[model samples]
Target: MAQMARSPRQLGTLIQNARLNRDLTQQALASMVGTGQKTVSRIEAGHPGTKLDTLFGILAALDLDLQLGPRNKGEPDLTEIF
Candidate 1:
């Protein structure tokens, strides 16, 4: 099955769902991460101005981690290069 690409809104929705599933309010999460409720709300609304640190804080607060990897396949043999 092909994985569907998620937009910012979709990503935000996923985060929001997780937050709600954990019975957390925006204010609660914000307080946990030492940020303002408005920051959390804006992030949940897919605002582009959300800082990377803020997002990381929220993710950490929610016990989440972000992973990044190559999207395409490419492998090289060292012997072949030499």
Candidate 2:
């Protein structure tokens, strides 16, 4: 399923959910992406300073794709999915 993330927080929530769905811990994901668990935690918490490479690495590890499109007006909150 595709999700619309209007902000870093929303994007982080989606990443967190995907990680949980795969039954992978933050540390496990960090290791897979050659980073520290703290970094993973930060990313999951929507740290605005997250680098593009790191984000892409995490997405790849989670087998996720990032697509860009015209933003929808008044889109529902991403958290509503849970």
Candidate 3:
């Protein structure tokens, strides 16, 4: 299912769900992502301090990706490179 995450907490929930769905524990995921279990725990708890690189790494590890689209025609996808 495609879940819409409009907040950091919502995104955290989605990531946690994906991890669980893959039968992965926070420790396992942390090991795979070269981070600590506490970091994973904090991430799942929606800690606002989580870094973008860390988030992206975890997402990639979970086989998930992010897409940023514009809400209007004049908006551009900033995620793309020139």
Predicted model with the maximum lDDT: 2
Q: What tens-digit string does per-residue lDDT give for candidate 2 at 1-82?
A: 7987777878999999999999999999999999999999988888899989999999999999999997566766556544
Q: Rank candidates by lDDT, best first.
A: 2, 3, 1
lDDT comparing candidate 1 with the true structure: 0.75
lDDT of each residue in 1-82, candidate 1, tens digit only:
1222145565587678779989999999999999999988888877777788988989889887776655443544334333
C-alpha lDDT values of all predictions: 0.75, 0.90, 0.85
Q: Highest TM-score among the candidates is held by which one?
A: 2
TM-score of 1: 0.74
Instruction: Report the error of model 2 at residue 72, Å.
Output: 2.1
State the lDDT of candidate 3 residue by residue for 1-82, as single tens digits: 5666656677889999999999999999999999999999989887789988889999999999898754665545434312
For model 2 the TM-score comes to: 0.87
Total clashes in model 2, counting residue pairs 3 or more apart in sequence or in different chains? 0
Ranking by TM-score: 2, 3, 1
Worst 10 residues of 2 by lDDT: 73-82
Candidate 3 TM-score, true structure as reference: 0.80
